[model samples]
Target: MSSVPQPPRWDVHRLPRARGRNFLVTGGNAGIGYFVAEQLAGTGATVVLGSRDRAKAEAAIGSIGSRVPGARVKHMPLDLADLDSLKASVDALGLDRLDAVVLNAGVALDRPPRRATGDGHELMFGTNHLGHFALTNHLAPLLTATPGSRIVTTGSFAAKSERLDLDDLQSTHDYRPKRAYARSKLAQMLFALELDRRLRAAGSTTLSVLVHPGGALDSLTPSRPPLHVRTTGERLSRLPLGLLVQGKDAAAWPAVQAVLDPSVHGGRMLSPRAFGLRGAPRIEPLWSHLADTTTAARLWTASRDLTGHDPTFTAPARSGGTEGPAAGPGEADASTG
Candidate 1:
């Protein structure tokens, strides 16, 4: 393990053992999120599925139970579009430590001029970047205290089209759904790298890694009861697009690799090799602009201002439990029920 173990391509069936660990996968009820949760659970990890709909979460949990006998899976209500829900969910998640958190929930937008969140930010940006920012900040303490923990953010190839306007992060002045999505993704990529830098500087054990599933389509994935409702459209659509993209299970491979690959380190990005659209997972180069430090700092400040949650690198002391420093800049004390 001195050098990053280059597996014979990214294969979930070959993932390292993950027993006695806990993971939280946002949007784990469907799509690649669900498969990521499933793959991790198959390896004996306790997985918490975070979804906006409780019914969807429960359905996902049930599906996991049936797919992998004795899978340790649970559901928690989480709505990334609403910061209040984010706060409440964190308070309710009473875990002292989490091995990894995969930020996978987001609005996959295809139309423009959509609705905004309660916070008044653009929907995609709010849900994709801002909400995750708050959640990670709040959970920083638990992650920092957990040895060799990681945060894997789900990124996208759409980010290549982003033209960042730091002043107009929400794209309030001119809004197009695709560009809005791209901008949010660019922001996420920057934040991931920046967060890694900060975590290392703070001497925390936690690491931040970003991974993307390139052009994955739902049509090719296996159906889960009530959740993966296989539609005629999916079957028909797969005829043409099936060869062009990988399925959800295949797409989840990179994230799974990032989670268990001992060779992977913080600030690295894992993505598909075939034009970033379909193939085995690999570490690929990204747009230089997306990793600009100055922009990352600006986005970090804006995120703090918008969400009011900050990562202080340490958690407050807990009696009869793990303890660390008190809340300081950008950090919060334990939730006061």
Candidate 2:
């Protein structure tokens, strides 16, 4: 084929402004992070950029403001690798209520031994999975108050690397950089679906969804992959897969669509259009097993325990897999990676 194709579309651009909406987007300093925040702020929403580096966040915010002059954009400190930082972040941004929260911050590590966070959990699992787990739990109260609130998170097509491992969430038993990364992402996907399920069961119709950029990044989490696999991922894009490598700019499309599209429902998984690689925005489903209510509940329970916070506070009991309200001041925050 001369060029790769994109995903199915359904006239999504007509969506109106996000006026009066307040959002918290992690890693909104640059890359897809900035794109997501920029799109939202451009549409007239108040966006709080959550990042580890205050300096970096400030720069990113400045750029966003410049792009969307007078855009309601602000910055807050959020270090997914450190639990203490997570708490400080909550205290800083835990407002009266929040309209949306997107978990987009992550690291791509080089082929290296597994690391741990300040809380002593595996770094990837700690930062990528646990960090958001606590943040979401803490902010549930705000979500419940807002009728159409959303929590959007980014996953990876590589999420299939391994199945959910309740037994080895920390990867203390076996650790391959790719496998561990996949596990963490899988954990994130499960959390997204499970939170959605819990909300529906509780008679709450708020939105919680998952998204991935496909094989969208030349660089991924800070932890590097094996040279061969990583190099292979980088190689195909420049050659045979050039058309499919829609670039990181397109990455924010799927996430932005998820955030903006009113038709999107809870439990949906979105990706870009470029074949097995990349494209525009389209709605897709996660692995069938990801929707399993049993696993969803277990994952939620385990996450609350791992993060040392109650995911659902007065959020009401959940049915399917989602439990807890969407917004509550977070407690017992933990790291992501």
Which numbered prediction scores highest in lDDT against the true structure?
1
Candidate 2: worst-modelled 10 consecutive residues by lDDT? 328-337
List, residue by residue over 63-126, the lDDT tens digit for candidate 2.
Answer: 6666677788888888888776676677787577677889988776657787888899888888
Top-scoring candidate (TM-score): 1
Report residue 19 deviation for candidate 1 (angstroms): 1.6
Q: For residues 1-337, what per-residue lDDT tens digits would candidate 1 score against the true structure?
A: 4987543433556555566678899989888999999988877678999988888888889988888777989887888888877767876888877888999988868886577999887899999999899889777867876767889999888887766897888888888888888889888888898898898887776779999899887777777767776677787878677667888888998888787666688998999878888877889886688668888888889888988877667422345865422211112211110
TM-score of each: 0.87, 0.81
Give the per-residue Cα lDDT of candidate 1 at 1.
44
**lDDT against true structure, model 1:** 0.80
Model 2: residues >4 Å from true position, as ranges?
1-15, 218-240, 313-337
